[model samples]
Target: MSVDTFAPCIFRMRQTYVTDVVRMHLEIFIQPK
Candidate 1:
C-alpha cells in the first residue's frame, strides 16, 4: 500500500474512533442532568 492510500485509511480509523468517543461522552453528560 502506498502512503497516499495508507495514510488516509489510518486517519479515517482514528477519526471514527474519536467521533465515537465524543458521542459517548455527550450521552454520558446528558444522562447526569
Candidate 2:
C-alpha cells in the first residue's frame, strides 16, 4: 500500500489502542474496593 494510505491506518490503530488502554485504566480506577 502507498505510504499515504498506510499512514492513516497505522494512526487509527494506534488511536484505538490508546483508547482501549485509557478505558481499562478508568474502569480499574472506578471499581469499588
lDDT of 1 by residue, 1-33 (tens): 999999999999999999999999999999989
Q: Which candidate is the best by lDDT?
A: 1
For candidate 1, what is the TM-score? 0.78
Q: Global lDDT for candidate 2?
A: 0.98
Best model per TM-score: 2
Residue 21 in model 1: shift from native, Å? 0.3
The 10-residue segment with the lowest total lDDT in model 2: 24-33
TM-score for candidate 2: 0.88
TM-score of each: 0.78, 0.88
Candidate 2 positional error at 9, Å: 0.2
lDDT of each: 0.98, 0.98
Task: Evaluate residue 14 in candidate 2 and report its C-alpha lDDT on the 0 to 100 scale.
Answer: 100
- Clashing pairs counted in every model: 0, 0
- Candidate 1: lDDT of 23? 99
